[model samples]
Target: MSEWRGVAQGCAVIVGVLLAGLAGAGIWIAVYMQGDPQPDVAKAARSHTARAADLLVTAHVDQQLAQLRTALPWATHLGTTVADICETYPANTGFTRRTWTPVMCTRTGTAYLAFDGDFREHLAQLDTALAAEGWKPTNNAGDQPGLVADLDYTHRPPGDATAAELAEAAARPNVATVRYTLPIPSTFAVPPGAGGGPFPIGTVEVAQAPHLPTIDDGTAAHDLTLETRHFVDWQPYSHTQLSTAYPAHGAILAISVRLPYNT
Candidate 1:
């Protein structure tokens, strides 16, 4: 009877040991199957593919060309409108801050950004980036870089060569370089009938630091006042109409002058 009991105990101990070994083997297999470490080759291949894709894009700009092709016609009208905003700011007395606020918030508006910076003297700089993309920023101490100002383009009758001579002598390389120092008025006003005499009916105090040359560079003309009916609001030229982004900003001015290039 004792021998049988001992034999049974020995069998149980062997079974226990075998079960423990099986459990240990199972744990080892589970750990091995799970993700243990980063896969070096796969990571390297993925990085290489990303770099290749970037290179492929840089090597080709057809995507940009395609986008421009679809957007050019609209861009032309928008550009012209922007030109009007700039050309007319100094002329309109009825324009308000609300209307001109977005003038410098976008591309061509950026060109006039500086003007906005100092309202006492000028409007916001028009961002020319839209019209002249990637063009370097320009500054000429309040002068619009290429603007031709004070240019008398009208020709005299056959006898008077003086007018023709003056116009010829004043021809400048870049019309935009013609700088104008406009007098800041105490108030904005237009009296009785419209479109008469020295606009704005106020004194324009010109800055004397940079002396005005004998030939007018369009730098001294300042007191501007536009008639109510002739006044054009800046709305259709907004980003919505201009960009694929937002709506057109309100307009504040409109200038129709024949300058150097017929001005």
Candidate 2:
């Protein structure tokens, strides 16, 4: 009977210890909670840096293209006037944190008649202008210097190119195409604001879109096409290939600038 009583007292002590431990834990949690209120993320502004980066890069594209227009008044814009997009990425591999970066693309083609005299001088001048704008010319494709403009018959069928047209394209290979890159110094690490999860892959929520002078008629649509070919295609800009269907047999230049993001 005494042994039974001792066992009961021991069990009671064990239960009391557990209850005390639980109570301490609860008190600690309450104190921790009291220290800082949960952030009212609802009131926070959507990332200014993300949007600023978007606008900055897009403006860079517009400015560069306008410069090109000034240098070569007769130069024709091929494809979309420009592909200015800010692509979102997960800062971590777990896809919890989000960040965004901007990429701008543009292409221009000139007439074959003007290719000989005007193209060379104008292209050099444009290069100088771009260099002044903090864009460095790179011959390395891996540098992701943006897109290179060229006569692209790859999308067309094998027999799509006639022997004469191919010869003509080959004969006039004086088109000057250059790619440029603008290195971004800041990391665009955007916090998850009032919203949860990152922005949709193909969509850009830029506040400055309405006030912009020129409409981006080509980039989003081409991005959609690219999404089909390669799922969630972050890079819509590539070799700005002028198809045989489109007669762009002049000076060709493609520019791409990829923004920085947190890893």
Candidate 3:
């Protein structure tokens, strides 16, 4: 009888250990599920970004594009729309915070003519038109690499131009960049209590920086496969550009204008 009583006590001890293990696992899972709380500034920045995106899509994008189209009547407006670019901030507190702010937008317009030919003249006209709209060319300080703030198409070698220059001049669908700094009021305005003053957001290279939207179309642009179809919102040019293939004479006009605040 005493041996049977000892065996029963051993079984009870095993059951007690199993029950404690299960309870500990449950507690651990609960703690893990309740991730670290976000900072108030992070929350404010996200909200501000959303509001800025909405304003760009609803009011600013069309208005600005209209002005541009009028300025460049020969160029076909491909697509232009604001996207919610996700930005991640790593914290030393064992968790990473992700937020979207400093909203970005990209525009692609094309001319049926060659970039090194008649399009060069048109671009100079565009510079003048943009200046009227408060966009000015940056000096050497803010000039971006591989992109020129002021394009000098008339430049020729001191003597006779080389064969490379001759071929480059006649190359179809070539690219020329013209950088401009526009003081965009949209980026400056923030929600109350955001705790940031009026300062320049710095140069925003939309193509290089910012994670593109998750949406994919499985289309190929040149050798690379472009999953995100440039436009994130349903703007006037979205549907037409998505359906249309880049024309044979299409001179790709990539514009990366940063709308930072005046410091």
Tens digit of lDDT per residue, candidate 1, span 1-263? Answer: 99999999999999999999999988976675542332232233235443343233322222322333243322222222211111212222332211211011010111110011222122112222112322222234324331211112111123455776756654422112232222212232222233333221111111111221122212222224422111112222332222322123222111111110000
Extract clashing residue pairs from model 2.
none
Per-model TM against the reference: 0.24, 0.35, 0.44
Ranking the candidates on TM-score from highest down gives: 3, 2, 1
User: What would the per-residue lDDT of candidate 2 be over residues 135-254, giving only the tens digit for each residue?
Assistant: 665444332331222112212223677887677665554433343445433323333341323321111100111111121324445535332121112323223333321232433443
Top lDDT: which candidate number?
A: 3
Clashes of 1: 37
Clashing pairs in 3: none
| Root-mean-square deviation per candidate | 27.5, 13.0, 9.9
Q: What is the C-alpha local distance difference test score of candidate 1?
A: 0.26
Which residue segments of model 1 deviate by more than 4 Å?
A: 40-50, 58-72, 75-244, 249-263
lDDT agreement of model 2 with the native: 0.37
Residue 149 of model 1 has an lDDT of: 15
What is candidate 2's TM-score against the reference?
0.35
137-171: candidate 3 lDDT, tens digit per residue: 54342233222322333232234768887666544
Model 3 residue 93 CA deviation (Å) reads 9.5
Looking at candidate 1, what is the lDDT of residue 54? Answer: 27
